[model samples]
Target chain A: MKKAVFIKEGQVAIKDAPMPEIIEQDDAVIRVVRTCVCGSDLWAYRGDDAKEAGSDNSGHEIIGIVEKVGAAINTVKAGDFVIAPFTHGCGHCAACRAGFEGGCQSHSAATNFSNGYQAEYVRYTHADWSLVKIPGQPDDYSEGMLKSFLALADVMPTGYHAARVANVKAGDTVAVVGDGAVGLCAVIAAKLRGAKRIIIMSRHEDRQQLALEFGATDVVAERGEEGIAKVLELTNGDGVDAALECVGTHLSTETAIAIARPGAVVGRVGVPHTGDINVGDYFMKNTIFAGGPASVTTYDKAVLLKAVLDGDINPGKVFTQTYKLSDIDQAYKDMQERKTIKAMITID
Target chain B: MKKAVFIKEGQVAIKDAPMPEIIEQDDAVIRVVRTCVCGSDLWAYRGDDAKEAGSDNSGHEIIGIVEKVGAAINTVKAGDFVIAPFTHGCGHCAACRAGFEGGCQSHSAATNFSNGYQAEYVRYTHADWSLVKIPGQPDDYSEGMLKSFLALADVMPTGYHAARVANVKAGDTVAVVGDGAVGLCAVIAAKLRGAKRIIIMSRHEDRQQLALEFGATDVVAERGEEGIAKVLELTNGDGVDAALECVGTHLSTETAIAIARPGAVVGRVGVPHTGDINVGDYFMKNTIFAGGPASVTTYDKAVLLKAVLDGDINPGKVFTQTYKLSDIDQAYKDMQERKTIKAMITID
Candidate 1:
């Protein structure tokens, strides 16, 4: 089976990799229907071995049909449609019980080659817990926004979780840093969560425009001091009640902190690389800093799936382009160039 | 009016600073009855120039009797008894609405010591919002463990808030780093929150013993990697479900992270100085980090006050010694020398 693998630093390729099979009684083998590039996947693609790395099947945000299941598996079975979150997790791990599905303990979800998630057909472990079965076949798969659901599977809920952790409230103003898909998602999320005003800080015109559509009550095009000042200006010089950082860069993280009013919270979901996780401003501001990776598995993914299924939300807007599994390089280039927000690929 | 001012680092003396008056339409003048030395005070006492030179009003934790009120003030009036949390707060601020009362906008409890609680007669700016009045007590000053409430005014509730921020649940195993008053209080708070097994990481026999009395199921005297190893060993090598860092040192902060299982939360209430706020392990461990200066005002202090008042909990055990207000120098010395866990100074 053709699968994506990281040959070395700065290289990703679709090569003939070994097919996967059920290893646990609660395991199932899923034939990949679709896969996509995630911001978290860029760490190794960009030669940054800092945040996460692996060569295994590189995609966990998968939409697939279960090809087979173990004898003991009961929740999901052969021929069932499902949305696989970024991790294959055991339901019983402390981390799993604590409401973090991405850190599932039983089945390693990283590169099976090294610790990747991209593959043709990969073994889905702890099937009862890891796979979210999509109910009743729809006439149009694209209409279902399955690709978007795959995308939403992690970053979307992550944005919402960031807001939840920061405890953003109704009539409160929240500023979002980093106009990545997650940031864009957070704009919608903060609005959905009842924030009276949502602000997005970004220089990208496209993202800024998207931020507005997604529910950014305001957008700050400035960076650093100017950006912080702009946020405070929108917030009556008191700063935001909550700041959501969706971009993992140092500048974005610090802006989230600097723009925070004292006692407010800064929810950071961006995966930071080599940079100071500054807490000096964080301490002086006396702010609550919450958020890590999204606990995609711990909470109910069905709610998000239903939103996508019902067309109430269209997260698929993030996938601005697409590619065949073999044209993975162009997909990477398109994403790196920022010409595309994200890319979807056909596994077949 | 007589006020206690820090003339310089390590030099504290009572002097005629400024007459108490309403600075804002919402201000009030409170006749401070008892203001205790807070753990956070040691920051300024150890020569924080910003505090020493700015507004040397030394305490944020105070129990006082309201002497005067602005016409607009409605929460309390002349002769009302109250306890001020660590920071002066305006109840109407966005930060306050979001439940972060420590960083209120209308009244900044202590921006600098230019205005402080550590004075004979203190001027409270957000008198309507910042003060919590004691119920049913006008003259019974010495009966309700006001000193303990004052002592915990910052640390205890701060510790409780730290655990709350970490999202500790019943049946969860939690590890507490730091054996100071905050740390000790965290042990009880963790138990109150239904933590099944509370572990205290400390070398001090007194603190460790107190932790046991406070409902800690286990105590670890080891430090650093070894201490973390013990914590992991106790949890069958996975690590505690939640960990709290009440001591804000780099070591304690690192240990809190080290001992937390992936997907677990490391709630750090410790006030950090210059130290590596390590995220390398956190990014991989995928630990959720939350907590900063606790929002004691965000919690039900009255319930805690009742607990102290009813003697359901004896947080007063922390006050090992007391001195007359004239012997405050000795109180500091006792606390500094570790001869007393905490010392109270009485004013006649």
Candidate 2:
């Protein structure tokens, strides 16, 4: 079957690869249905992350149908539509028990996407804690409906957790950095959390329009100081009560810290590439900073999943472009050029 | 009247000065009843903090008798014994109302300790919100119970606020960084907050003994990695649930971060003196780092004052040495040589 493999470096291509096998007792083999590209994916493709020795697979955001399950997998069975959230989480660990399953101790599911689909089939270890089964029609779930919430497996929920960790309360104003798919989702998530005003910082016109529709009360097109000034102007110089920084670059992180009001918080979900992270800049303001891997298992997946079934938040708006599995490289190009917010590939 | 002046850098002397006079409707004149020297005071005496052009006065923690009140000072009577919490607070800023009165918008009254006592009397602006008056106290309150709850003005409440801002919960294991007066106070504060295991990292035998008396479950005499390893070994390799960093240097800050579990929080109250801070290595741990200046006005000063009155918590244990006003220079030297944890000087 075709899988998106990092053939050498700096490029991704769909090529024939050996199918994954269920070696773990609680593993589940998922037949790929729909998968989306992630921002973290660019870390390797852009030569920002360390490259693998032989070949590396490149996808963690997966929505698929279960084709097989280990004998211990009673919670989910074959022929069910499901989403794999976080990377992998052991059912028990100090972090998991404390509701921070995203930083699970014993598993490296997402980081080891070598076992995931950018392919036709993916094996999920600790399947009981990894897979969330979709309750509705298994045979007829389309990208429109699945993308609305299935994407919550990672992006939507991850960004929402960022806002939540920053303690975004009702009627509080929020500043969302990086106006990408995750940033737009955070705008929607902040609105869901009852944020009275959400200001999204973006340079792209299409993403800005989407941000406005998805509940952004204001938009700042400028980057850094100019953008922070616009946010301060909108927030009456009091600065934002909270910020969700989706882009992990130093620039976005600085902007997030710059725009937040003292005693407020910045939920930084951006995966920092190799760079110095400054926490002193936030000292006098009393800002609370918390964000790492999204604790996807901690939240009630179905609660957010319901917002989709109720047709309230259209997270699928981020899926601006679609392609077949064979043309995955072009999809990466669209995302790299910022021409597409994110890409959805049909993979039945 | 006489004033204490740092005549030469690192040297303090008593000199003739004028008595303080009320300058505004929110002002009050307080006769210095009792004052203690903080480690921060030694910063400028040792040429650490920024020095003003030929400036005098260093003390910020003062317990005094209100000698006069302005037209708007309705909170206390002229003859009241009060705790001067801030250098000054307007009591109306957003930060004030939200209880972060230390960072009040009009920061005029924030830290104007240059006009502080090293003198017979001190001028207090915004008397209504800046002072905490003891309900029942006789004249010469200093010689008797003045030292009891007065730590609430700065050290005691400041230490507790450091733990509180991180939202330290019941049964949490806490690590206290720094062995200064504030660090010892943090041991007491974290204990009061119901930390199950309180570990004090200190090399000083006196401070360690004080920490044990203040309810420390354990003590790690090591400083950096050895100290962090001891703390982790105590917690089964999971590290502390919360950390209070009372020393603000990069080393102390890193120590606090090194000793907490993922999702644990570190509340820091010490003011950073120099160098950039780095938390990039700590990003993956998902720790919530917060804290700044102790918002003494933000906490229940009256409640804590009552606690001191009830003899439930004795904060005066931190003052290991005493002196007359004439011997203050020697007191500063005693503190610098680490012979005393804190010094108490009497004006009379």
Candidate 3:
């Protein structure tokens, strides 16, 4: 089997690797159908994350078909198409039962699951709890619907998590602080929540256009203080009711905080690059900072899946570029260079 | 008029000061009938907060009789007894209307209203917006009622603000990270909000007693990680639903986050002595960091006031020590030395 491997900083390649097999009672072997490059992947690609080059499996978001199921797996069967949440969990843990599967006590993103989905086959543990079966036959869905289904695995659910935790309401003015796939999807999520006005902070024309198409009412190309100023101006100087900090940089978080109204919530979903949160800045403003890795398994995937099927939201529009598994290197390059908003990978 | 002055970092003295008079259309002159030393005041007394000795007015919490009212002051008039929120606001600003008087547009804690309540007469700006009437004649209430009324000015209201922003819902298990007046009051607030169990972290026997009396179901004397461990153990290892960081130190905030359940809210009302918030710690925990300087003027003062009048709560019990106007130095010393939980100063 061929899987994406990290050769070194600024390098990723598809190489021959051993095939994954069901090793646990709840494990399942899946044939990879679709996968994608997440913003967090760039951390290791850039050598910022402590992940050693050419070590461990890569990629988390996955949409695949169950080729085999372990003895204990009852929820999913062979030949079923499924969406795998980025983080796997044990269904019966206290945290999982409380709807925080991402922080599940039995198995978590930081501790378990090692195979990457950018390959012909992958092993998924706790399949019954970690995988949600897609409704309907694969042949009945359109290509766009398939792409949107792939989003439910990570990006779309993550964006919805941002909007949900920020408490975006029907009359709220929302600001999304990134223009990447998750940020664009957040625009869709905010609109779904009935936001009165949606502002996207983006510097690139393509992303800005995608943002508007996804439901952004306005776009601010400025960065830092200027971007905050633009948002404040649009909000009549009171600032937006909710802000989604989808870019993990300190500046992005600061801008999100600065452009939020008193008592507004700034929900941050991006993998953070910095550890500092200016206590004085948020303390004085009465801002509520909420968010983390999205608990995709806990989100109302059925509702979002329905929305996609019903043509209410096209989160798949974020896939501005796509490539086969053989072109994984180029896909990473396009995404790293900001030449593509997001790259979708088709596995055969 | 006699008022308390900070002669030096470790010194406070009652000395003659100019009598206050209404200077603005929305201003009112109040005769200080009761005032108390706040936990935040200890910051300057301990030389932690930067304050030039004898440089500015001192004290913020006060219960007083309206000595006189400006032409525009409609909510309060001469002879009315009222409780003043520590922070004053214009009331008509967007932030104020949003129930964040601490961040009011026209006037804020950062910009104006420096006159302290530890004086015979103090000028209160935005009188109509900052003052809450006691709903009865001063002579009709008992001494305990007056002390409880004084709590409404800062401690009680600030504690309620912490619980309110933390989103304490019925059946929630709440952990208070401090056991001072504010923390004890937070216990009361949590109970009023229908929290199922309240845990207070405190080593002092007196404070722990007060916490239990105020409705704490458990008390953990441990500090730092040990404290968090105790809280987690008490909650059957799931951690509390809401954590109130009533102590401003970074350790307190970190502990608050550490002991909170995933998706829990850590409400902080302590005047922050540290400016750092570890984004990674909270980001991974899915913790919602909410709170700031309490917008006491926006709180349901009428309900709290009625509670006190009806003997439903005895927040005044936190005021374990009292002093005459001339004993201002002793009051500061006792509070600074932790000999008393809080100090009440009689200005008559």
Candidate 4:
């Protein structure tokens, strides 16, 4: 099997690796059909995260076809096209039942997909609960639909999680604090939730235009205090009813909190890069702070899959550039250099 | 007029002060009918909070007779028996209309009652929206009823804020991290919100009994990690659905977050005495953190007043000791030394 490996800082290589097999009674072997490089992958690529050099596995999102299943896996069968959610919930735990599979009590490393989904073959555990079977194989759908299905594996649900956690409601004015792929998806999510207006902070021209097309009502091309000022100005100084923080830096987190109105919520989906937050800021305004990894399994099984099937959302647009599996290094390079919004990888 | 003054650490005194008069067109002069020493007062009494000695105007809670009104004060008038909430909201601001008057954008010092409600008279600005007029004068109600009304001025509404922020629902299990007047009141708040079980953390025997009387279903007399462990044990290790932080220290706040189940909310009503919080702790569990000063003006007008008048609650029970206005020093001493849960001050 060909899998993506972290060679060292600033380098990722597709190398021949041992094929994955069904190790757990609930596990299944999947032949990867589609995968993508995530923004979080850049953290290690830039030498910011603590991932060790020469680590073999990478990537957490995937749309795959089940090649084999353990005897105990009854829900999914071989030859089934499936979406493997990043957080593989067991479906019965309190956390999973409550729609927070990201914090599943019965979670194991196998459920995390840390073995690298950006490969020709991968092992999926908790298959019965985590794998959402698509109605047909990848060849049955348009290119756009396939990308949207792949998105349900992680980013789309993550974006929706931000909107849900922020308690976005009809008639709310929302401010999104990043212009990355996830933030663009959040714009679509905000619209799906019926937000009256969405002001996205973006400095990149292409990203800003994409955000507008994705349902952002306005854009603020500023950063820091200036960005907050611009957002507040757009809302007539009342700040936004909900703020979506899609960037993980301290400044981004602070901007999200600052842009929220009194009694508003700041939904932070970005992985935090900073240590501590001055909670007194939220306390003084009575702002609600909530967010974490997307409950992809729950959302996919509940709404995202149906929404995608029904054409209610087209998250596939986030992938501005695509590449064959052999061009993996170039895909990472383009995304890292800000040359692409997101990179989609096609496997053979 | 006589009013409570901070003499120094461990000391408070009743001294002559200027009589209050309607200073703003939206102001009203309320002759204090009843007042009380607050738990927050003990912070200053213990010299933990910065305060200049001999500074007058100490208390914030009051149920009184409106003695005079500025020309614009039409909602409340002279001779009207009123519950002057600790936060005097203008009622028309965005924060107030949203039921979060504690962060009212139109706030002024007069609306805060920082001039002192323990005095013979208080000049309450934002009177039109800030004061809740009772049906009759103080003489028409029993001492218990008056005490309940006084509780609505701050503690009861403040406690209710915690439960409201925690999003407590019917059949939910709630954990309260403090056992002071506010925490005990929160026990009642949780019950009123239809929580199936209420766990209160209290080491004091008297307070534990009082908490039980106030609807606490269980008591954990432990502290720190052990306290969290006990709470988890009470909930069968799933942790409470909602955790109320009535104590503002870092440890208390951490305990509230630690004992909540995945995706639960930690409602903190206590004024935070610490600086920063490790937000990652909350992010990991998708726990919602929401709280601040009670929107006393909003809660009192919306529900607390009716609840008290209907005899649905008797928050007055929190006042375990009584003191003549002249014995202000002893009142502070008793509350500081933990000799009483709360002290009621009577003005003659």
State every prediction's TM-score relative to the real structure.
0.85, 0.92, 0.95, 0.97
Q: Per-residue lDDT for A1-348 in model 4, tens only?
A: 898888888888888889888788988999999999998888788887778766854588889899999988888899999998888778887677777878777875446544467889988877888899999888899989989988888888988899988889999999988999889889989999999999999999999999999899999999999999998888877788889999878899889888887788889899887567867556778888889878898888888899899999999889889998888888999999999999999985
Which of candidates 2 and 4 reaches a greater DockQ? Answer: 4
Angstrom error of the Cα, residue B56, model 2: value is 2.0
Q: Write the per-residue lDDT of candidate 3 for residues A97-214, one digit (tens) a residue.
A: 7566767767755544434677788888777777888876677788788889888888898899899889888988999999889999999999999998999999999999988988
DockQ-derived CAPRI band for the predicted complex in model 3: medium
lDDT of 1 by residue, B45-155 (tens): 666535635456455666777889898799888888776666555667776775666656665445411236666776776566666777754466563477666655676
Write the candidate numbers in order of decreasing lDDT. 4, 3, 2, 1
Better of 2 and 3 by DockQ: 3
lDDT of 4 at B68: 93
For candidate 4, chain B by itself scores a TM value of 0.97
**Which regions in candidate 2 have their CA more than 4 angstroms from the true location?**
A7-11, A44-54, A70-74, A108-116, A140-142, A273-277, A300-303, A310-312, B8-10, B47-54, B108-115, B138-145, B273-276, B301-303
Among all windows of 10 consecutive residues in model 4 chain A, the one with the lowest summed lDDT is A107-116
Given candidate 4, what's the lDDT at residue A334? Answer: 96
User: DockQ of every model listed?
Assistant: 0.42, 0.47, 0.56, 0.63
**lDDT of model 4 at position A308:** 92
Instruction: State each model's C-alpha RMSD to the native.
Output: 4.2, 2.9, 2.2, 1.6
- lDDT preference between candidates 2 and 4, better one: 4
Q: Lowest summed lDDT over 10 consecutive residues: which window, candidate 3 chain A?
A: A108-117
Per model, how many backbone clashes are there? 21, 2, 0, 0
Candidate 2: residue B179 lDDT (0-100): 84
Clashing residue pairs in candidate 3 (N, C-alpha, C atoms within 3 angstroms): none
